[model samples]
Target: YLKKIGRRGKIDIWLVDGAKIRRDLEKDFTNFAEYYYFPIIPKYEFWIDRESVPNERRFFIDHLLAEWRLMDGGMSYQRAKEIANQKELSERKKAGDLEKVINQKSEFSPEKVHRRLLDKTKDEIDIWLVDGRLVRSAFDIGFTEGGHDLVYQYVPKNEVWIDDDVFAKERPYVLLHELYERSLMKSGLTYLRAHRKASRLEWRARHSEQILDEFFLKFLIKKGKI
Candidate 1:
């Protein structure tokens, strides 16, 4: 649930209980420390996950504000996010607590999954846990915690990948997001549309565990595995 903390200039700041969010969503590395959406409030509302330490909170806030402004100025979200990430990276480096990890993984190497498969049903799609950091380093640097075949490189034709970095409690939410996004794409939704809807579902899942149960149930029903 979101609690209004205060106003930041013209934007409303809300605090999210990130642990509860993780527990409710059943995901590990969903990795959204802060985010903002337009028209959800008067102009924009900024949300920060309470899981962030005090020293890290301001950096996330700075990133959100920068991202919001860039998007407001007609910049693409991808470009804006890249710039914001760079900004945050620079800030963290300045704080002297940032250590860039060197990825030694190979692109074509057979990576092991944390588990065999999320569900083994009649459906052809297979979901597996993967080293998301390695994937990002060797395959696509833009790779996040969750990804699937349609919009990503290196993924097989009918597979969903969950980052092994995600917490055991939160893996389910990330799986839900990847599965929903893939389903929407297969149903002919554009990647952008499908991604937006999936992102919203992920957000809702963060707030309510019931949503997770209902979504998984629907998924099982669709797979005829119920």
Candidate 2:
């Protein structure tokens, strides 16, 4: 469902709801933010996921607009994406939440030493901070900077992978999503199903208090373990 929420200059801002069709159709709509230009309709649109974190929505919008402006100005996608990414990261840092971690190596060597063992739930899940560039090069996945066992890649069968580029403050939110998704998958849910559930929980965590406690409580409620 794409609803026009507002307008910016000549572009239309839309809120996209993938909850209804995400699992079955797996439409290329599983995106936090995207921009589209319908020349036939003579319209320009920027679509943001309806469930995105309230705090980060503006960042996503800014990034998309920046990228679109550059692309519309004849810049290549690669160049535009890199420029937009850096700008977005800069804004996130200004928000005082983008804590960056430095990695010693440049290649795709999954470093377990820097891995974190999270005991948030009863399960002990390993989370490795990997190079986003390396991951993108090695795998043809569309993930911006996160992955789990759902895709057969680096790390063990039960580990989650986060981009080292992710800031310290935002890491927990990504970790929360990955861990919740893994838990649901382990409980016999399909990858898409689990992913959507995790995304919802991540949203809740960003807006509410005691995020970890809230996450566990909701999971338990879903499993009737409460």
Candidate 3:
């Protein structure tokens, strides 16, 4: 059941279960995601565990908060634990006010970590190429031993590292889409929220770039350059 819930600022939000597709159609979650240009939320599956929590009951965040795990001000589970370990954080939870954990001043901020890793300006682009062993290090958590394709760390404030999975020109297109969507982020939306909203626009950006490429090719052909 595909549905458009609403808009989170300038971006549109859609809801669908990547795992639950028509069994008879021979479709896959990754294919469905690529077909829609949406991100796959591994946390939803809880690692193959059966879960169907209602909207109201699905409070907090955890497991792996990558593309889809991104909430406006959500913190990583490890960061949460670091907070939980803090003497002051424990007091807040005892007072039934643990939500403040996100407000504290400390390191382990996944976004901040990513930002530092990027260490680039809005106009600058950084691409890292590492082996499979460093995949988990890049994420600090996620990225199991199995391996993964191109990963958009988040906003351009973060670096996009490509593993040894045969890097090519396609990476630039993905990077462009990420940068474009991040550019669309307005004053109110958080980086995470902005990404979920930019899903649709990302595809459009990619297609437009392709159109320009075709135009350039035609021009070159007319000049007999190719």
Candidate 4:
């Protein structure tokens, strides 16, 4: 089986953003590392891989970046990271790794049920599990968003970035936090306040749901009917 799996089974550790991509594997791959992220053309800010950018649809990512004032260096730190990922993805497409591994359905696709929440958004949401180191570099967050939707509640576009280190039980909470917060933001709430409210509600539900699950499990153990 190992032979069949072959040497192509190398792990690709993804991160929340590009700038901190090296924070995790750099130490592990010190001697054997091959630096992939490089400065972009002209101004030469470093560019690196995203979790995975799907090419299933038309995109003017480059044009968007230019209009986004990304090249003028007027971009925010988060936007800078976003541009780097976009640049790296464009380069990857040129190298022919765009659709198969990066854009393949086997890698990412939207689902009706993520955990228990329904992503009723009009577009397909692409979800990615990124490296723990990458999550840490961004302040120990369990999840983040690359979503580019106009109305996050009513019609959010696809993108959900997750920390691979998040525990199985906690994963749903992380996803819930992101999704719920987006719904709030769509209602015109400020990010800071929306996040605060979302986290509180989600955290409460998290503990409450555990009790509900425990009751169900115990009842099932006693041969009680649902």
Please tell me which predicted candidate would have the highest TM-score against the true structure.
1
Tens digits of per-residue lDDT, candidate 4, 145-226, equal 3222333321225555444434444444555556566667777998889778865765565557774344334323211111
Residue-level lDDT tens digits of model 3 in 115-179: 12212323444444333222323232233111111233331344444332222333333333344
Question: Model 3 misses residue 203 by how many Å?
Answer: 2.3
List TM-score per model, in order.
0.53, 0.47, 0.31, 0.33
Q: Against the true structure, candidate 1 has what lDDT?
A: 0.63
Candidates ranked by TM-score, best first? 1, 2, 4, 3
Position 52, candidate 2: lDDT? 28
lDDT by candidate, in order shown = 0.63, 0.58, 0.32, 0.37
| lDDT top scorer | 1
State the lDDT at 21 in candidate 4. Answer: 30
Model 3: ten consecutive residues of lowest lDDT: 55-64
226 Cα displacement, candidate 4 (Å): 24
As a TM-score, model 4 comes out at: 0.33
